[model samples]
Target: MAPLMLFVVSMAQFIDIMNGSSMTVALVDISKALGFDSYSTQWIISAYVVTFGGFLLLSGRIGDMYGHRKVFLLGQIWFGLWSLVISFSTTPAMFCITRALQGIGASMSVPTALGLITTTFPAGPKRTRALSVFGGFGAAGAVVGLLLAGAFISSVGWEWIFRFSSIFSFLLFVVGYVAIPVIPAKAVTQKIDVAGAMTATSSMICIIYYISTGSASGWASVQTLPVLIAGLVLLAAFFWIETRLVKNPIMPFRIWRLRNFSSAFVAILFLQGQFQGFTYFTTLIFQNVMGYTSMQTALAFLAHSLFAVVTFTILGKVLPKYRLKPFILTGFGFRCVAALMFAFVQKSTSYWTLPFLGLLVHVIGLGTSVLPAQITALKDAQNEDQGVVGALYSTGMQLGAPLGLVIVTLISENSVDVKMGETPVEEVMKSYRNGLFGVVALGVLGAVITAFMMPNTVPAPPAAASAPTTAPVENSTDVATVATVGAAAAVVDLELDEALAEAAEKMEMV
Candidate 1:
């Protein structure tokens, strides 16, 4: 039952991730079918990203206050319905809007799924192994999405992408209903932080909108700059509300005090930024520069998918034995090397050469680093706060994808000084190489920050003997009573000091 539950949740993750990656491959076909320009086509992806990233924090907190299982089921239903709606889209607006609505569902589902894992699995090796499997499926989903999207597009049509997602989502909902155990809410009395939710969600939407459009619209243009500043201001306001206004904040400020959690958040942000950007450019280079069919482009990523699965499987066994720092560093190191190799890629480069090798190394980095980060982030979290903590970590990833894409797009566009369709093959290659260098720079930054900020080791769990037990006392003699009282007093003092220290540390971190 436990393994089946894990499978259901993991497949939910896989389906969500696969939806986005598959859409990437189908974008051109969709654009042509809908009679939209390239500029408008980008909104298809952006719409999903904005709503997903924006709502994640609130959704996570909702899962914590309500029940994860209930929220997960709701999200699954919402996602399936929206996916079905998207399949019938006749215009870009219809597609984008339905996609955005679908993202709301993803926002609800993902963090809650993580919450379920944290609550169900006891911390330490069992939890670590569960997280690794979850992360592995997610990693595999990205590549598999590409593979299936190509096949779907080539054979039937791009519309089937959403149709399939809808079918899978509904099926998942049915299976999940039976498999997932109902965990009760930690605090049913806690009120939703409406002010914080509004501020945070709006700020994220603004910031993401700016990032999504800045390259195309001009960074300083009215459509981009004002929204960017507004987003920042709202973000500042959200922090203020969280710290002062909200009694039960959507994202509690205290969570930032956990050094590993904070570091993991930053690490995942940079890691995802590089991954999204790298994948974007590589896909373009394959289809546009090398003139490969969509199916071929998808096949090119097969090696990456295989390597990621194998790496995660191995890491699941190895992680419990070693500290995570080395793996994190090694993961970033792999990314740096892969990006550098890609930066030198020629138009004529063979699939079996640099492309294959780079994919292999890049997947290794993803497998090595991401699972460890997920484990590290959850390690210090109290069971009740798991949903929000996971949400925050995922929010970083959501934001990072668009941020990375914008940075690379801006860099590449400026480097070549020519529009994509109009550029010569040599210039296009040069632009892509320049964009990869940006990924290399991001990798270096992530590695350096992670090395310094991430703790070398997490504190060990308390021993079972030290844990408080509720069994009635067998004896109530005076000497035994006194001994019990003294021990309880000492424990109380120790707990108070620990709590105070944690409070002070959280303040300092903030």
Candidate 2:
């Protein structure tokens, strides 16, 4: 039963991730088919990214108010329906709209699915193993997706990509209904915080949309400036909703108080940021300076992709024996070292030298860094909060990555005419190096935060060796669990308990 549930959850994640990778690989072909230019084609991807990041918090909170199973099933149905619709899209507008809806569905499913996993597995090796396969799919599935999309586009057609997703999604939907438990709505504690959710989701969409457009349209764009300012205003409104005005906040302020979680969030933010910068600069080196073919550029990343899968597989088993701090600390060190090495790369550097070695080192850091940070952030997580935590985990990546890439793009934009074959290799090398130096600094900062703020010790095992197979058991320990956080978060979570405690204190005072 547990295995079946795991299968459902993992496959849900696999399909969601594959959607992005497959789209990226087939972008050029799709553009030609849909009559899209370089500028217009971007909307196909950006629409999906913005909507996914934007609605995560709201969706996650919705799961908290409703049962995760209901929400998860609804999202799956939504994703599956859109995947079929996408195949019929003949125009660019039609294609982009369908893609955006698909992304929203994917976002809705992921956090709720994560919530299900947290409830299914106890916090020990069982849970660790479950999460490993779940998280590992994200990295390995991307590479696999590229290979599959290329194969399908050449042999069958681009529409087959969505066709395949729809077929698989239906199968998943059937098995999920049978295997996953249904929690009654009466089990829910709080009503939906609609005001808080709306403001936050709108603000995030506005911010990510601004960044996505600004990167392409130039930072000084007059149209882009209005979006940026509007996003900032919405952000201020969101903060006001959460901290000052709301009686029941969508995001409780005290979730930010977990030292380990906060530290992990910061570290991963920098890690993702630098990784994006490194990928952009590396792609330029291969295609622009070294003049590799598109196929060759894709192939260069294959090794790192494989390395990530194998490394994560090993770490899943190895992590139970040691503290996460060592792995996180070591991983960030590797990240800094690789970025620093890449900063010194010359125009004519060999494929097997520092460039190749640096890719290896960087993936090592990435594989190691990602999982431990996830483990640390989700540590001491309560059952109900799982959806929100998972959403936050992903949001850091979606938002942090854009910020990193934009900064690097700005630093490296020196009018190097590689597309027209007019620029000097010497100029290209200078631009690449400058971009990489910024990444090196990002890596270093991540390492420092992990060292100072994150927990150094491995967590103690679950209070009992086993939680019941049918229902999740709550932890009773005093390791800064939900009650402690809720007491600080708002007047809502512990109202009954808090009122009693206060009354008891008053009787003793008399």
Would you estimate the TM-scores of all the predictions? 0.89, 0.85
Model 1 lDDT per residue over 222-334, tens place: 87899999999999999999898767788878889999899999999889999998898888888777889999999999988888889888888788768898888899889
Please give, for residues 358-473, the per-residue lDDT of candidate 2 as tens digits: 87898788777888888787776676677787788778888888888887777777433333355577777777877887787777777887788887866546543363444553
Instruction: Quote model 2's TM-score.
Output: 0.85
lDDT of 1 at 295: 97
lDDT of 1 at 6: 91
Indicate the worst ten consecutive residues by lDDT in candidate 1: 469-478
Give the range where candidate 2 is weakest over 10 consecutive residues by summed lDDT.
470-479
Name the lDDT value of residue 133 in candidate 2. 72
Residue ranges of candidate 1 with Cα displaced over 4 Å = 185-188, 419-422, 458-510
Question: Clash number for every model?
Answer: 0, 0
